[model samples]
Target: MNLAFIQNMGGGGIVTILLFSLAYFILWVYCLVDALRSNFKDPNMKLIWVIILLFAHGLGPITYLILGKNSKTTN
Candidate 1:
């Protein structure tokens, strides 16, 4: 994004946006790692979810966290 535009948005808005972005990034990474380490019933399911995470930036991780996490096979 343009740093100039962000600078013009005032302090509180900037802080809130930065914090939300950071939190989102953390959640995305956590979901990616969790998907990688966990076993799924179908081998292709892992690949599918990974692809989803890679492409579907906004909703992919949230959907995985809410729905896909439960679909993993327990050791």
Candidate 2:
């Protein structure tokens, strides 16, 4: 484990980046699980959301949180 990179990041930079990265990962996983568990109007939507989350990285989960969440149908 090379911590030299962290030291070079300068004054809490690595910490800030790590926090944001962790937050993003959690959000992405939550969105991914919700997409898998929830029912959507279109049966194919779950697959689409999953694909987007896996490939689109940052923007994918954010978009799904904003838009895809509302698109789920109540059972």
Candidate 3:
């Protein structure tokens, strides 16, 4: 609830934060790269995904991964 409480938790909070940040970073990078390489039916979709990944933080990449893919591909 307070700074002292967080401090008393020692490395747990710091480790958790670091781990979450790392995971988010990895996910973001993966999504960005995938979006860049993806073949969208509409070329504008690539730009849209890039913009979303840039400004939407954790949710943007997720949205792209979930909904931005070209469904025509089997891979």
Candidate 4:
């Protein structure tokens, strides 16, 4: 609420922020690797999706997870 109250929390806020940032970075990296590893019938489509995911950051990754091609084999 107040600046003094925030200051009283000392390094706790900084630690929390650092932890969240690290987690985000890890998730971003995981998404990148997953994008690379995915198998799509169209290589260009796969590349486009990877580019979207890499450039759009959080939103792109969520979209890829929700709407990108699935790699399951079809009979």
Q: Best-fitting candidate, measured by lDDT? A: 1
Off by over 4 Å in 4: 1-9, 69-75
Per-residue lDDT tens digits of candidate 4, residues 43-64?
6867887789778976886777
For model 2, residues 1-75, the per-residue Cα lDDT tens digits are 778887778968977998989988899899999999999999899999999999999699989989997788977
On lDDT, the stronger of 1 and 4 is 1
Per-structure clash totals for the candidates: 0, 0, 0, 0
Q: What tens digits encode model 1's per-residue C-alpha lDDT throughout 1-75? A: 657987689999988999999999999999999899989998998999999999999899989988897788888
Q: What's each prediction's TM-score?
A: 0.87, 0.84, 0.80, 0.67
- Model 3 RMSD in Å is 3.2
Please report the TM-score between candidate 3 and the true structure. 0.80
lDDT of each: 0.91, 0.90, 0.82, 0.74
Worst 10 residues of 2 by lDDT: 2-11
Better of 2 and 3 by TM-score: 2
lDDT of 4: 0.74
- Of the candidates numbered 1 and 2, which has the greater TM-score value? 1
Which candidate, 3 or 4, would have the higher TM-score against the true structure? 3
What's the lDDT for residue 52 in model 3?
94
Best by TM-score: 1
Q: List the residue pairs that clash in candidate 4.
A: none
